[model samples]
Target: MMTDGLDGVVAASTILSDVDGAAGRLVIRGRSLDELAGRTSVEEATALLFDGFFDDRPSGGEWRAHLGQARHAVFAEVAALDERLIRHGPLEAVRALVARLADGEDLATALRLVAAPAVFLPSYLRLRAGHAPVAPDASLGHAADVMRMLRGQPASSVEAAALETYLVTVCDHGLNASTFAARVVASTQAGLTSAVLAGLGALKGPLHGGAPGPVLTMLNDIGEAGDARAWLEAALARGERLMGFGHRIYRVRDPRADALKRALATLGVEAGRLAQAEQVEAAALAVLKDHKPGRRLETNVEFYTAVLLDALGFPADSLTCVFAMGRSVGWLAHAREQATSGRLIRPQSRYVGPAS
Candidate 1:
């Protein structure tokens, strides 16, 4: 009679995390996600996520150096891939690049595999747009190299720092749906590369991290601040969700949204878009609070994820690619951890269909 299984079973014994969706709490490697977002570097966060689990964690500078090396190593491999079928799309190209990393069996090789998409997708965008994608450099920081490969120039110090902050902040949360999927694959004793591919496929879904781009489209459809509330109401009546409004977790405002909003401002975002997002946020918050006074629904990470990526000179389409850069760290840690546990993650399913 285990119809709906009870929640929060002790799935594993790890010092990694606990996400209290009800209390709006997300603790990572011992600190709250709010406490870590934008306050730490990707390398720092990776070290934290892998702490106690791995004996050797690189410093921020060292990790950057290693990823740069990975970038070059992967680029040579991508050259050998079927260029005709490269697909010229972020998810497809990135998936191919991620899958290619399995050729190397070591952890460092595995990291490079995971890091390739962060470097490759941007390059693919440029190539698709008829611009030559620049290669990565080992001397720069992680964010700076990623920007350089995509844009043919290095990111400004402020922009680079902001991007790095984002990568670190999102590197890992608890067992979110995507991370959980990765663990499930890894639990099969599938290699880490196989596990990461599972994560990317899961994240490609709109319900997961893929909604940020459409949030921008939603804002565009409203056209102006004056159109927001009316458009939102109509959309709601039609059973449409205002992108970036509700969250699966977090009853209050998502702590990640504000941190990214701060970064957007620091990066000198366009005023018009920022103003529109602000209006939509204000109108949505007021309406939601009044409509469901006791409910926990609030602005989630997608809200500012839309605004921030938009401000970075990326078209609305680049949201998932950028998100992949940040999320890959979390995927890598979870995949490796699950593989180390040496247990399959099979859950019993309820049989409600026509019983025989």
Candidate 2:
């Protein structure tokens, strides 16, 4: 028998992070996702993932300094991509520019690969929007600097914290589609940049990193609390798959969804709209329950991800690009881990055709 999508298959062992779908828990480096959300900076969480994993891993203040230096190092590469910016969205443009970086599984190469998006994504977005790119602040933390570059102004405490929470929450998960792609490329002795390119390619697909923007679109379509039930019912009647309602894993509520919802609540913007989102969520949940009683279709991260990022003033198109900024660290860590395995990730396929 074959597992069609490799569901429930254990392909590799990683010390990076674990996804306990049955329990609705995510743990990174043995720390629970809830504990790290608002309490830790993205740099700190990156360091946690890197500790004891990389040979030349820098920790504490030094890690932040190293990442800062890496951001500055990629500045020229980001600028060079300006002419080609019109050809791709921010995510694709950043992927192409990052592929041009030096290749290797070494510590310096990994740091630069991880920093590429943090440095390049905002530049790509700003340039595409007909604005001059803002330079990265070598002194500020990763999340704050991303916001700074995007808006060309310093982020307030709340804005910085919200982005940091998002970055930290999404940093890594167990053998996700993109992470698996990165590992496969790394297993072939490819450089970190090549592996990361593979990961980004996978993430570009709708099944993985594509749903967040649509949740906002769905909310915009609903418009009012009173219309939410009827709107959802009409959509369901037409056999439309509701966005942000279900997950492949997570029998219970998605912990990441809950985490992001709390982050949006903390930011305290668009009170009326937030209430509308709540109403829509409840209506959608009820509809899903009545329509499909056997399946547990609860809200996933994309719901409030839409709310929080929209509230932060990001255009819907750039949402996935921002996701790449956070997930880059996880990809690098997984790439480095796969490099140490020394075995190519080759799985045999069963032949079904008749023998000649």
The best candidate by TM-score is 2
lDDT of 2 at 338: 81
lDDT (0 to 1) per candidate? 0.73, 0.85
Tens-digit lDDT track of model 1 for 185-268: 878877767777888888888998789988888888887545777887777778777789887666667777787787877866
Model 1 lDDT on a 0 to 1 scale: 0.73
TM-score for candidate 1: 0.91
Flag clash pairs in model 2: none
lDDT by residue (23-106, candidate 2, tens digit) is 999999889999999899988988887776577877577878888888888887876775666476767788888888988877
Model 1 superposed RMSD (Cα): 2.4
Error of 2 at 317 (Å): 1.1
lDDT of 2: 0.85
Span of ten consecutive residues with least summed lDDT in model 1: 1-10
